[model samples]
Target: MSSILTNTSAMVALQTLKGINASLSSTQNEISTGKSVATAKDNSAVWAISKVMEADVNGFKAISNSLSLGESTVSVGRQASETVTDLLTDIKGKIVAAQESNVDRDKIQTDINALRDQITSVVGAAQFNGLNLIEGTDDVNVLSSLDRKNDGSVSASHITVSRQDLTSGAGTFGSTGLTAAAYGTVNGATASDFTSDAAGKVAEITFGVASLAANDTYEVSIDGTTLSYTAAGTETAADLASHFVGQINALGLEGISATDEGAGVINLVNTKGYETVAVTLNSTSDANLEITDLNGGGAPTDGDVGTIEQRASTIDFSTTAGVNEGDSFKVTAGGSSFNYIAGRGETMEDVAKGLKTAIDSNQPDGITTRVQQDATTGQWKLAVDDANGDGTSTTFSLAVSAGGTASGGLFGLDNIDVTTNEGAAAALDNIETMIQTSIDAAAQFGSVQGRIETQSTFISNLTDALKTGIGSMVDADMEEASAKLQALQVQQQLGVQSLSIANQAPQSILSLFR
Candidate 1:
């Protein structure tokens, strides 16, 4: 133990000092860099986790930028749509003034043309960074989220916005690959053979024997108009029928006439041309009046319509695939052509329903639609007819064609020449539709912008939360780091003095050897 060669005390002291120096260096690093785990050498697992979270935070920032860009682009489109709507409203006012026969329509026409040109300008200029949502049918995706899984997999999420096309361009069409019979395809002679437009279809409301009742009530509904009759002073069924018939005839409802066909049968004939005349009798009293089913011969069910007034034409749909997303069809009937466009990812059912809506809403006259599916063949059918039409017009025809551009435009509004009376009348309707289109576009863009804004805000908040989490894992605690630095410095100084003392022990051993 006292040998000069083996200085155990000095060696132990030197090792202790070396350990203290290493700790001091680590504490100093934490103070300077302000991070407890800046490198893997400090805390490998924690540093790696913090690095990953930092990467995600950066990714979220990039997503925020994308959302901001998308929001601005959509905002521009919304503003332009609003502008177009205002212009159309102004044009409508001019057309309303032109409706009077004494007004100078030519001057109104000039003003209308100016407004039309302004709408075109707005549509063409509504682009943002080469993206025009109001003129084309395309989708835009904005990056909104970055998801990191437990297994260390990353995936990107986006918000998809659809374009609202308000362009007033020519419509295109395509084949549904099927055909349907038009109204009056069957001979008009037989009532059963005709459709809802069975003009001569006899609608009879018959009565039973003279039943005694005071104030017994019964309601008769003909073509949606109801007539309620109450028997007074114990009147017979015949008297009630006659009284009701006389009351109906006195009112002189258009296209309807009543006559006593037989003993107690009040036969009703709708001479208003090819349309439906429906008659229903319901008893509100205790006595039930029997109603005969005269659908086949003189009267028809709603579907068993003849070539009568209020008839429905059969429109079958045998659609197929291989259709382009923008494919559409135009059906011309009764002076108006209906344009139907297919939407993205829509089935044939959706297309057919859309067509039914278009035809019913914007059709000539009071044409109504009754859509049903052929149960056996599993095919779709649309029945379109002017519910109050007269079959006298042999010029009526239904034709369908393709090769039209599907636009959100008011059909032919750009070509409105309101100088002429006919043109002025047409412009009035067209301008309203144009205004509606612009309003719809504005609404759509507004919805998409709102979604983008929400996503942007969420991403910002999420990014901040992630940064805080990463800081919790790797950020140096300044108070704790300061305490450790002072303690390590004191230990370093003590270790130096101890090493000096141990070396003096080695000197003592050297003296013994001398």
Candidate 2:
């Protein structure tokens, strides 16, 4: 064991010093780089996880930038819409002033024109980085988040902002594609006058053939008054009709009279001026009775049984078929054409009001429009009237077409003339709609801008949390590294001294060999 050629002690001491030096180098590296797991070779699993989280933090930073951009764009739109709303309110004030006969109508009209031009300027200038939200009908998306799945897959999330069209473009009219009968109908042949006289309109209710059964109930409602007749196992249609006529006549309703014409026919006449009497029929059993409008020659129905008396020269739009986007309604009056194309989620009520706005934009002499809806029947009617009451008729016609581009949200702002008495009256009604459009646009933009701001804040906080988590996983503890560095240096120095002593033992063996 003490032989000079072996020197086993020196070999053991040299190995110990080599291990201490390696540990010291690692401790120095941890102090310099500030990461315990700088490479995959150091701690493979932890390094991989920290690297992935770091990448996500970078992505979240970019998403934060996108959110800031989107918020700016939406803020511009909101401000512009609010400004347009204020301008419209000012124009409404001018229209109210124009209603007075003593006021200077021409001066008021000029002021209104100036306010409308200002609205146009605001909408045109409401853009952020070449993106305008209030001038078109397209949507924009902003990147909000990067979602990582449990299985290491990632997907991006976005916040979508809907565009609000606030332009006043009249839009192009397409070729005739919609069926007139499908969308609406014009009831009166004459366009200007609704025949009003002391003698009222007549409607006939004819009962259809149906087999009566025991305990069957037949119900009829006239002007919200309900009357019912129940059969005791045996009754003829004529007997039921006679009973209804007597019951209706006993009510003594003013301006209405009913008489049994024949077997099962009852003639109901409405003598009321400018009002319609609603006649409804219902039966407990479907086979008990069937009623229909005999004058109109319509099929037998269950609910409404009599023909509706025409009270005004009306254009009635159908409510059964929903209004689709791009459906255009055009009104030609006084040799001028006015059109309104439907937008998304519009109804027939919107169509009627839109047509009214279109016609009022020109303010034709001797023509006025009124939009009315029957509460019971839900039918939307546009009543075109002679405003002067002089029986002077102007050329008027209404037609509908499909496949046309929709009009802008503020469609009739340009033609809002408040100079004449009729124009002032119509402008009062039309300005309210324009103001509402701007208000809705402003509200929507405000809501989305708030959401984007919240998301931006959340992303900022989330990024900080991720950085803290990554630091916890792979970052070096500076205090612990400092202590370890000093400990490893002392161990290296002690091992070097021990190796030197072992070499001295080898030299003593060399002396014994001498």
Which portions of model 1 show Cα errors greater than 4 Å?
Answer: 175-308, 311-327, 332-405, 415-433, 510-514
What lDDT score is found at residue 467 in candidate 1? 93
Tens-digit lDDT track of model 2 for 80-185: 9999999999999999999999999999998988998999899989999999998767679989999999999999999999888888887767676667677787
- Which regions of candidate 2 deviate over 4 angstroms? 189-310, 318-324, 331-337, 376-379, 386-399
TM-score of 1: 0.69
**How displaced is residue 102 in candidate 2, in Å?**
2.2
The residue-by-residue lDDT of candidate 1 on 286-370, one tens digit each, is 4344433343454434321122233444455554443345557444444466666654543545444545545544545554455
Best by TM-score: 2
User: What TM-score do all the candidates reach, one by one?
Assistant: 0.69, 0.76
What is the number of backbone collisions in each predicted candidate, taken in the order shown?
33, 0
